[model samples]
Target: MQNYTKFGKNININNIEIAVKTRLGQPHETMRNGVMKERKKPGLKKARKASQFSKR
Candidate 1:
């Protein structure tokens, strides 16, 4: 907590750290949705063998 003083007001440093990571999680979750959509596209392999034989 003491080390966080450099970022947050020295007296409230620990408080700021608490919300730092929580605020970033929202964008991460949205990126997952996009990633899942792309993975579902036919371009990606569903299995190792499926991908190898796909060209055939």
Candidate 2:
């Protein structure tokens, strides 16, 4: 893939500021959102409850 419009040349991206306001970063938020979504899905609760019974 061509990085620039003229030809296939690597572009300099040295000034990129990589961070988030909180310490955990955006990835943590995304993962937390996914878990929350899965918990809300149908049949998920039943499966989890079944696992709890096996731990007894």
For each candidate, the alpha-carbon lDDT, in order, equals 0.38, 0.35
TM-score of each: 0.21, 0.29
Query: Which ranges in model 1 have alpha carbons more than 4 Å from their true place?
Result: 1-11, 26-56
Model 2 lDDT, residue 7, Cα: 19
lDDT of 1 by residue, 1-56 (tens): 33433433332333443433343322121223223112243445457568678878
**What does candidate 2's lDDT look like per residue over 1-56, in tens digits?**
22233211331232111222122223222224223111254588789999999998
Candidate maximizing TM-score: 2
Choose the strongest candidate by lDDT: 1
Position 50, candidate 1: lDDT: 87
Report the error of model 1 at residue 18, Å: 1.1
Worst 10 residues of 1 by lDDT: 25-34
Lowest-scoring 10 consecutive residues by lDDT in candidate 2? Answer: 15-24
Inter-residue clash pairs, candidate 2? none
Model 2: residues >4 Å from true position, as ranges?
1-39
